[model samples]
Target: MNNPIVLNAFRFVLLLLAQVLIFNGLNFMGTINPMVYVIFLYWYPIKENRAVFLLVAFLLGLLIDIFSDSLALHTLAILTAAFARPFIMRFCFGVNYEFQNFTFKNTTKIQRITYLALLIVLHHTIFFCFEILSFSHILLILKKILSTSLLTIFLCTLFSSLFSPKSE
Candidate 1:
C-alpha cells in the first residue's frame, strides 16, 4: 500500500502541474474557471498533523498563486480551507472522517463529493473574496463565487470519481 504521505506529495505535484499547465489556460466567460487542483487538499489524509495540514495548504495555494500570478492571498485562502477542514469534515462526515486516517477506499462516492464540494466552495469563496478585497465590485465577486463554485464542483466530482483511491 502506498503511504498517505507519499501519495499526498505526489498528488500535490500533479495538481500543481495540472493547474499551471492546463486549467490555468482555461478561462470561459470570465466565470467558469475550474480549479480542480484544490481537490488534493480536500483529499489529503485527515489524520495528518494540524500544523502540517496548514503548512501544506499554504504551500499548495502558494504554488497556485505563483503559477497564476494573480495575488499572494491565494495562499491565505488555501490555508483557511485547510484550517477549517477538520471542522467541516467532522460536521459533514461525522467523526469517521478523522484526519490522517480517512481514505477514499472507506468512503462513499456521494459522501466524498458532498464533503469535497463544501471545501471547494469554502476555499474558492475565501480566495475570490481576497482577490477582490475592495467593495467596489461586490457584484462581480458574487458572480465569480457562484460560477466558480459550480464549475469546481462539477470538475471535482468528475476528477475524484476518476482518480479516487482503489483501496483503504
Candidate 2:
C-alpha cells in the first residue's frame, strides 16, 4: 500500500468530485469561486518527480475542463501551479523539505499560510487571466482573481487546519 499511484488516483477522484459538485456551485456573490480541487495537487507527494507530477496535474485539470465546459483555462492554471509548487515548497519549508512525505508540522503556520496563499493566488490568477481573455476588462478580471483567491485560500486553509496532524 506504499504505492503513491493508487493513493493519488483516489485523491484525484475525490477532489474532482468535490470541486465539480460542491465547490462549483459555491460562488459567494457570484464573484468568489474556490478552486479546492487544486488541493490535491498541493498535497501530492514526491517533489522530485516534476515531469510526472505536471502530467498528473494537467490530466486533472483537463478532466475538470471537460466537465465544466470551461475549455483549457483549468488545464493551464493547474499546470502552472504544479510547475511552480516545488519552488514554493522549497521557499516555505526551507532546507528541511522532504521529497517523499512532506508534512505540515515541519513548517510554521505562518509559512504554511504563505505557501497556501501564494499557490492559490497563482492558480486563480492564471485561471482568471485566460478566463477573461481581455485587457478591456482588466479591472473586472483582477477583482475576480482577488476575490476568488482569498476565498479559496480561506476555505482550503480552514479545511487543512482541521485535519492537520499535531507535532509530536
Candidate 3:
C-alpha cells in the first residue's frame, strides 16, 4: 500500500476519472472549469524518471483532451507544466530541491502553495491561450485563466490536504 508506483497509478486513474466525469461537465459562470487533474503533476514523485513523468503527463492530458474534445490543448498545456516542473520546484524550494531525497511533505506551506499556484497558472495560461487563439479575446483568456486557476488551486489544496500522508 505504501509503494510509490501503486500510489501514483491510483492517483493517475482517480484524478483522470474525476476530471473526465465530474469536472468536464462542471461549469461556473459559464466558463470556469476547475482542472483538478493538475494535482497529479504536483503529487508525482520528485525522484521519478523524467521521461516517464513527461510520458505520463502527456497521457493524462491526452485523456482529458479526448474526453473534453478539446483537440490537443490539454496535452500541450500539461506537457509544458510537466517539463517546467523542475524549474518551478527549484524556484520554490531553493537549494533543497537539488537533493534526491527531497519531498513536498518536507517543504513549507508557502513554498507548496507557490509551487502549486505557478504550475496551475502556467497550465491555465497555455491552455487558454491556445484555446482562444485570438488576440481580440485576450481579456477573455485572462478571465478564464484567473477564475479557473483560483478554483483549481482551492480544490487542489483541499484535496491534497485531505489525502496527503501525515508526517510521522
Best by the lDDT measure: 3
Candidate 2 residues 43-146, lDDT tens each? 67744478888999999999999989999999999999999897887888886775445566556889978988888889999999999899999999989888
Best-to-worst lDDT order:
3, 2, 1
Which pairs clash inside model 3?
none
User: TM-score, each model?
Assistant: 0.89, 0.88, 0.95
* Predicted model with the maximum TM-score: 3
* Cα deviation of 86, candidate 2, in Å: 1.4
User: Which regions of candidate 2 fall more than 4 Å away from where they truly are?
Assistant: 1-3, 98-103, 165-168
Tens digits of per-residue lDDT for model 1, 35-125: 8887877678766588988888888888889888987767887788788887877877777765556665676667777788888889888
lDDT of 1 at 155: 87
Model 3 per-residue lDDT tens digits across residues 32-110: 7899999998889888899999999999999889988999999999999999999999899998888867777688899
For residue 48, model 2's alpha carbon misses the true position, in angstroms, by 5.1
Cα shift from native, residue 46, model 3 (Å):
0.2
Residue 76, candidate 3: Cα error in Å is: 0.3
Question: Alpha carbon lDDT of residue 161, candidate 2?
Answer: 78
